[model samples]
Target: MFIPAIMAGGAGTRLWPLSRKEFPKQFLNLTSDQSMLQQTLARLEGTGHSNPILLASEKHRFLVAEQLRLSNVATSQIVLEPFGRNTAPAIAIATFMAASESPDNILLVLSADHNVADVAGFQKAILKAQALAENDYLVTFGIVPDTPETGYGYIKCGDPIDDNGQRVSAFVEKPDLATAQRYLDDGKHLWNSGMFMFKANVFLEELKKYQPDVFDYCQSAFNNMQSDHDFHRIPEDIFEKCPDISVDYAVMEQTASAAVVSLDVGWSDIGSWDALSKVLQKDENGNNLRGDAIALNTKNTLIFSENRLISTIGVQDLVIVETKDAVLVSHKDHVQDVKEVVSTLRKNDRNEADSHRQVYRPWGHYDSIDNGKRYQVKRIFVEPGAKLSVQMHHHRSEHWVVVSGTANVYCNGEKKLLTENQSVYIPIGAIHSLENPGKIPLEVIEVQSGSYLGEDDIERFEDRYGRVD
Candidate 1:
């Protein structure tokens, strides 16, 4: 049986503003109504695969679960890494888990953030890789290059093997324009798609052979994993000792059993705004406009507006993205350099680099609408049947006014049912909790008054989400 292992942990810093560290691009609906991660799971609907094993970060566990629930993808396991140790360790843990179930299980490892336009072609490649995998070959799907693109790594194919697979000759890093052209001319190189298929035992054996330290560390971490609800938490200390490296550096490049299956499916990692623009529908002027965006005399440009109108008069070959708190305007040629902007924001300790004004929580989300030196205002939304932690603030007092639906609020051991336009006040140091008692989402406007109005001021006494700190 094929067990899909979806690697869903990535910052996706290149697509910032819209994609934050807390909420990355994989969770965003870039192409269709479903998110990239959801789309990744949906594409395997008819592929006769077992429930997927999702690997995500601890901070993103709720996002992964929520997205999967929305997509109706029942996950076999949701492994939570305390910290990222790169693809090598991530894949090793997943392989270990799958092998525990059955050593002969074929694992179809895929990144949750990729976009494959041709689902049929992708499934066909998987079938071919499965055949090669059954023969104990570590198989990777190599995309047939259509252009001399330097952004992606290239895989050089060797002599053809059985079942339409080729022995992997060598893995090459991203090259310059001239070298990329040379590789394209050679016709022996393909873009490294990072999608792989292999029997669980075969991959584990290769990993143990090529990089024993990574394998050993990953095994130790997985063995000591703790289960919390849907999340399987890996021991942070042991996993942190694992060397930080990619799978290519750890095993695939060193293993002699590595093989590549050429895939002609249209695939894009959507690494930048330019890549997203290429996949999206373009207007007569070659402009891809989304949300409340208007472009005039624009050619080969992408404009994405989330909460406000973004209008361009005469821009060409540009990407303009406006979110709640940040705006990114860059030329298409320089889209790859957008990561440097995120790096700069990090160095400055700016929160904008990590999240937006609106932050997602397990129960719901809250948007910071206004703030002052001694007060703050927020718009909070609570999903039906969800409740906030029973907690108290040390330095702030809160007043919640229900705007829609019904709110069951508990303040200072007093329970009250608040309907539309009704308000409640929780004094400083008073234990409080908010719940959505209605079938629909409960929207509340919150006004806070405090000398120190930070999120860290909350002291949780009880939480259903298993949050302790």
Candidate 2:
């Protein structure tokens, strides 16, 4: 049986203003109502595959589990990484874990942030790769290059290894525009999709051959890993010492067992706004827009407006993204350089580099709709039967006015059932917890007034979601 290893820890900064470090693009509902990660999970259905193992960062552990829960995936398949060490370490750790169940099982490694339009074509390619993987070849899915796309690395096919698979001659880095055009004209290169299928033991053999140090590091870390409910907690100290490297550099580039399968599916990594625009349908004016937007004379532009109405009078070949906390407007050609914006924000210690006005917790989400000096107004939503941590703030006091549903409020040592329009005060140093006691979501307007209204003021004493840290 095949086991999927979903990699979901990328920060995806280039697609920012909507995608942030705290909650990346994979979790966002990019193509439809479901998130990219959820789509990835759903694609595995009816494939006769075992439960997937989700490899994600510590910050996203709960998020990953929650997404899988929404997709109705089994709970035992989630793995948590304390820190990101990229694909090599993650794959190594994952293979080690999979081997514990069965050494001969094939692992299909898929990135969570990708978009595949044709699931049948994808399944065809995966089945072809599975055939090669069963024969001990480490197989990678290579998308048939439609154009001179310099954003992705290319795989030069050497010769036919199987009836449907090709021996990988070499992995080429992102080429120049001219070279990429030549590659497209030659019809011998394919875009590296970063998706692979291999026997767990074959991958481990390659790790031992090409990257023994990484193999040893991950093996030791996995051996020492502890179970945290449904999550597998990687030994932080040991896992952190593992080399920060991608699977391409650490194994596939050096291993002789590498093979590539040509995939004709419409696949996209959705790395930048331009790439996302390509997947979305365009309007009469050639504009791809979401949320509340009005484009008067826009052509070949992607506009994503949230929390407000965005009007574009005469924009062309541009990407305009608006969130509650930040806005990004850039030329479509310069979409790759959007990472520089995140870098500048990081240098200036701006929170926009990390999160948006709406922050998603394990329970639900909170949106800072409006704020002022010494006062901030937030709309908080708690999922049914969910509760925030029992915590106390040292400097700030909060007033929670229930807007809908019912809330169980714990302020100081007093507990009260607060329904719609009921308000409660949580003064400074008073331990409080907010719970959704109703079937629907409990919505409230939280107003804070204090000298310090920073998020760090909270001292959590008890948390049901295991977020004591």
Candidate 3:
């Protein structure tokens, strides 16, 4: 049996407008009905592994918790990094956590946002790698490449090993078109998939030997960890000192007992629009159309619309994605340059670089429907048994009309229960709170009229999420 640790912290810049810094690709439902994170959790089933230990950024704590609750995964062992220090420190922290359980337990490391079409093949490869891990080998699953793809690094395989695996002859960086073609022709190279397996203690020792400073910093941060809600947060100042490097550089490249298992599982990282288009199902014209899109004379294109109907005419080799706040139109060949748009947006202090029009909170979510010079409208959802903080706004007054279920409104130390079609007014500077006391979800339409309608105008008195003292 092995323990799984899923790394979920990443900024998917190429998939912007749909994926943001606040909400990345892992939390998106790109392929199926479930999100990639939920699918990763489901991938653990039938493998006889323990519940996964999720590692994410501190800002993504609620997202991690909500995904776990939605998937019915009973794992509360989430480790939150202050900020991303790359994979080495993250895996080091996970290794230390897993070692606390048992040093001999194998830890299978996986990314939370990878798409694998062949689930059975992936499980089989995991079993193969676990056998090598049992023999003190640092095993990484290498994807058998079908095409001369230059986006990924290649791994050259040596002689066969004991567990249907091969010794890793060398790990090569991303190659040019000619080198990639040569590697494909030689048939001795595999794409580095970044999935690894080894005993918890064995990985810790390898990390300590090669990257000693990183090892020391991660161990110190882990010793100073704090348990908050359903997550474990490493201290910010200490974790920041950990080197910003990947596990491939810190341990895998320097390890002596490295092994590679050939896996042909139809895997894709979904890194870019072109990569995502290749992984998704396509029509006869080689087009993948999602969500209220109508295409005419379109071929080799991808159109994704999140809100309204998007009709395209005479488009080829293109990607057109429409979100509530922004839209991205680009040629498929230049999809990798989309990150330049995100960089420009960030330089201009644009909120679109970080968030969507709809924002999620610990309680529920709210969508901004309309906004004018002095008035803004929001469609708010409050989950059952969830409550907003007791706070007062200095510059805005809110009018809330309950559209569904029930609401308990507390304003200025007075409480009132409101049902469907009922309304309540919260004047400016009135200490107020809202809660859903019923078993069903409560929906409300809130209209705010104020000189300043920004989100930073509230002073909290009491909060359940530890946002305030």
Candidate 4:
């Protein structure tokens, strides 16, 4: 049996303003009603594998768990990386864990941020690749080049090993425009899809052979791994010592057992706005307008409006994305440079570079509605049976008015059960928490007044989701 190992912890900078460090493209509903991660889980149906081993960021544990819960995938295993050590270390860690259970079990590595339209085609490819992997061949799916895409690396097929498998000849880096066109014309080159399948022990052996330090460090890190509820946490100090590198650089390029399976399944990495446009439904003018967007004489344009109505007049070949906090207007031709803007934001220490207006928490979520010099307003949602940490903030006093459902408020040696339209006040430095006791969701409008209103003010004494470190 093969276990799906999903890599979901990427800071998608190219699709920025929409994709942030805190909530990346994998969790966002960019292409369909289901998010990219959910679509990936859905793609696994009928493949005889329902549960997946999830590799996610430490901060995104709640998001991953909640999404998986909603997706009805009950048997997922989440390994939280303290920080990204790139794909090499992440995959190594996963391999060690899977090998512990059964060395011969196959691992189907997938990127949670990728979109695959043809589920049947994708499943068929997985089975075909499984046959090669079972023969101890390290398999990588090579996407049949439909376009001359310079954004992706190319893999040239060597000689056919069988009817379904080919020996990977060359792992080529992203080429120039001319080189990309030539590769497309040659037909031997395929887009490196970054998906792979291999036996867990076989992957570890190849990794140890090519990158011994990575294998050793990850081995030690996995040996010292700790579990928190449904999540597995790695030792930060030891894990950080591992060299940060991509799997292609660490293993695929160096391994002699590397094999290629040319896949024609409709897949998109959604790395840029232009790539996302291909998956979306476009109108006759070649425009994909989502969420209250009106276009006049617009062609080959994609407009995504979140919480606002956007109108484009006589615009052609443009990509405009509007969010609650930031709006990105870029010509689709130069969307690749969006990462430059993200880099500048990181240099400036801007919050928009990492988070959105609506912030998710284990309890539920909170949307920052407004803020001033000394005050902030937020709409908070608490899931049923979920509670915020028993905590205190030194800098801010909060007054919450219940908008819907019911709330169980605990403050400073007292607990009060509050219903809809009721209110409560939490003074600065008061130990308090909010809980949803009803069957439905609990919504509250929280107004903060104090010298400082920041997320760091919370001092947790008790937390169910393990924030009490």
Q: How far does residue 338 in candidate 4 sit from its true spot (Å)?
A: 1.1
User: lDDT tens string, model 3, 83-133?
Assistant: 999999999999999998899989999999999999999999999999999
- Give the per-residue lDDT of model 1 (tens digit) for 1-469: 6999999999998999789889999999999999999999999989899999999999999999999999898774999998889999999999999999999999999999999999998888888999999999999989999899998999999999976699999999999999999999999999999989999999999899889999899999999999977789999989989999999999899999999999887899999999999899989988999999877777888999999998888779999999988999999999989889999999999989988899999999999999999999999999999999999998999999999999999988889999999999999999999999889999999999999998989899999999975
Which regions of candidate 4 are displaced past 4 Å? none
Q: How high is each candidate's TM-score?
A: 0.98, 0.97, 0.97, 0.98
List lDDT for all candidates, in order. Answer: 0.93, 0.91, 0.93, 0.92
Candidate 1 deviation (Cα RMSD): 1.0
- Supply the global lDDT for candidate 3: 0.93
**lDDT score for candidate 2 against the true structure:** 0.91
Superposed by TM-score, candidate 3 places the C-alpha of residue 25 at a distance from the truth, in angstroms, of 0.6
Can you give the lDDT of residue 259 in candidate 4? 96
CA deviation > 4 Å runs, candidate 3: none
lDDT of 4: 0.92
- Going through the candidates in the order shown, the clash numbers are 0, 0, 0, 0
* Model 4: lDDT of residue 342: 89
Collision count of model 4: 0
Residue 465 deviation, candidate 2, in Å? 0.8
Q: What is the lDDT of residue 110 in candidate 4?
A: 95
Q: List clashing residue pairs in candidate 1.
A: none
lDDT of 2 by residue, 1-469 (tens): 7999999988988898789999999999988899999999887787889888889988898889889889988858677888889899999888988899999999999999999999988887888899999999999989998889998999999889868799999999999999999999999999999999999988998899888889999999989988868889898989878999999999999989899999887889999999999999999988998999988977999989877998988779999998878889999989999889899999999989998888889999999888788999999999999999999999989999999999999888789999999999999999899999889999999999999899989899999988786
